[model samples]
Target: MLKSEFAKTFAMLATGLSCVLMAQNTLADAPEHRIINLQAEATREVANDEMQATLYTELNEKDAATLANKINSIVNQAMNTAKSYPKVEIKTGGQNTYPVYNDKQQLVNWRGRAEVILNSQDFKQTSELIAKLQESMQLGNINFEVSAEQRNKVESELYIEASKAFQQRAKLLLAPWGASNYELVNLQLNANANRPMPIYAARDASFKADSIESQNIEAGNSEITVIANGSIQLK
Candidate 1:
């Protein structure tokens, strides 16, 4: 009877040990790890506040120096016109003079070209000035932009929002898995602005107007995008 009782007690202990070992092995094999990927976009419309346009003009002559001088004169006139508007800023650009080659590859004429960029914070005034000047000079291209200051502010706010979004997702995910919290492993971020394309036109056309038509300009909102990709340990 004593030996039988001792054997029964040993059997019970062995069974309990086996159960504990199995539970530990299950946990070790199915360790909880998670990865959450999320994206956030923020956009707001500000005024089409700024204007960017280029002036392209050319002069032709037999003498290279004469052609250059004529081109310079036209450039100066354009500058003077830009000065009339306090909001407009005219920046001198590259000037190029190349010899024209005929079928025989002989230099036939000297051509001079110059470009200038005009930037204005006031869209209405800039557009009006561009139309007026188009009659006297070549209209190269026009574009609209959001100020650097505005873009930076938007990006900063969006990044904060993205971080919060990531944390929220992690919390929700862990809660469903019967986990109390998650340990963040990594994080990364990025952002951009959408602007209008430049308008390009030929130099020969006159900007002079019996009636001037203003373009419907919209400075539409800049977009701030943030991508959150990382791993978390659930516990």
Candidate 2:
């Protein structure tokens, strides 16, 4: 009888210890009904401070080398012309050469295109360079965006504002719940740009190199929004 009683007591103690460890692990995360979701956002419209444009010269020839040479010559001239605009940055974009197929499926000739890209903060200078280059190469596309420096500055400011707003809202909500304080269980910060996209009449026959003139451009605006989304546990 003594041996049986001792065995039963040890079994009970071991079972209790296992249950305690399991309960502790289960409660490691926040308890039910203790978590609350909150979200705050701040937004600002900033003028687009940068521009990028692509120009390309396409040609066809009996030989691939001849086509490439013609395309390269036109692009080199375009880059050289862009050098006149000190504020604009000019770089080679891409060059592609492919075989041209005839009605008989014969690879009769080679078609190629050499491209150049222009980047600048000065819209006037960029437009002028585009007009000059358009005299040779055709305009491909144009895009406007906020510069990196300005974007970073605006996003930093908005993050602080959004975080503070989130904290304030949390405190206000807790006051109604009769809770003295709350814990920040999780937080997520995000930013997105809502801006109008620039449209261009690229590759249109009406926009031929000989008929095109200086382009009118607008910098427009981009809305930079920062959102603070998170959940907090009531204390």
Candidate 3:
């Protein structure tokens, strides 16, 4: 073979090898880092299947002992009356005695306030008990609440929803940067319940007769909001 031809052959082989090396390096050196961030929120409405109410009864007694007995009878009767509702849980509550002051700052009489809280899973039953308690022990204000079981279930669903939203956001953010593949490095979930307004007027027994009517009670929707945050990496 001629020396020139041999040299030309070697040059051609070197050029092909260089092209292969360059292509391999380009693939390996593809984008190594990218910015991917996402945010999401979720909400759910739950019906309040449970109910709570604070019932107060005030009595005026000439003697402490007699007043105690009288107040006890009123509370006991009210509690027992509440038991008539198969779904209601009746429990004894407050007992207090204080001196009543007159306009001249003189002791007019002894005032005793007795009370109990009625809790039930049945909304209608709870409402009826509150109304009837007023006729007897003079029902006080009624505050509403949700059961523990229901709240936990709602919160779990909310968390799942929030996680889905975060994932969607991360995908959207990464799409523009040419990165759609990612794994959740970390995830956090938070949730809470808000208390309902207190019923102060229910404590007023000035018109027990008028209060006999079932209090117009509406168990408003409880909001469960879930927030999830996590870091994602895309290539």
Best by lDDT: 2
Tens-place lDDT digits, model 1, residues 1-235: 9999999999999999999999999999995665555444444555555678887887789999889888888888888888878888888888899999899999899998898888888877777777766765777877777777766776788778777877887888877878888788777766655665665666544344433464665555444465555667778
Q: What C-alpha lDDT do the candidate models reach, one value each?
A: 0.74, 0.85, 0.76
Task: Give the Cα-based TM-score of candidate 2 against the true structure.
Answer: 0.82
Q: Tens digits of per-residue lDDT for model 2 on 58-101? A: 89899988887788889778878877899999999888899989
Determine which window of 10 residues in candidate 2 has minimal summed lDDT.
205-214
Against the true structure, candidate 1 reaches a TM-score of 0.75
- Model with the higher lDDT, candidate 1 or 2: 2
Better of 1 and 3 by TM-score: 1
TM-score, cand. 3: 0.70
Worst 10 residues of 1 by lDDT: 203-212
- Give residue 150's error in model 1 in angstroms: 1.5
- lDDT of residue 217 for candidate 2: 63
Query: Considering TM-score, where higher is better, how would the candidates rank from best to worst?
Result: 2, 1, 3
Model 3 off-target regions past 4 Å? 1-38, 101-108, 177-180, 194-196, 202-217, 233-235
Instruction: Give lDDT for model 3.
Output: 0.76
Number of clashing residue pairs, candidate 2 = 0
Clashing pairs in 2: none
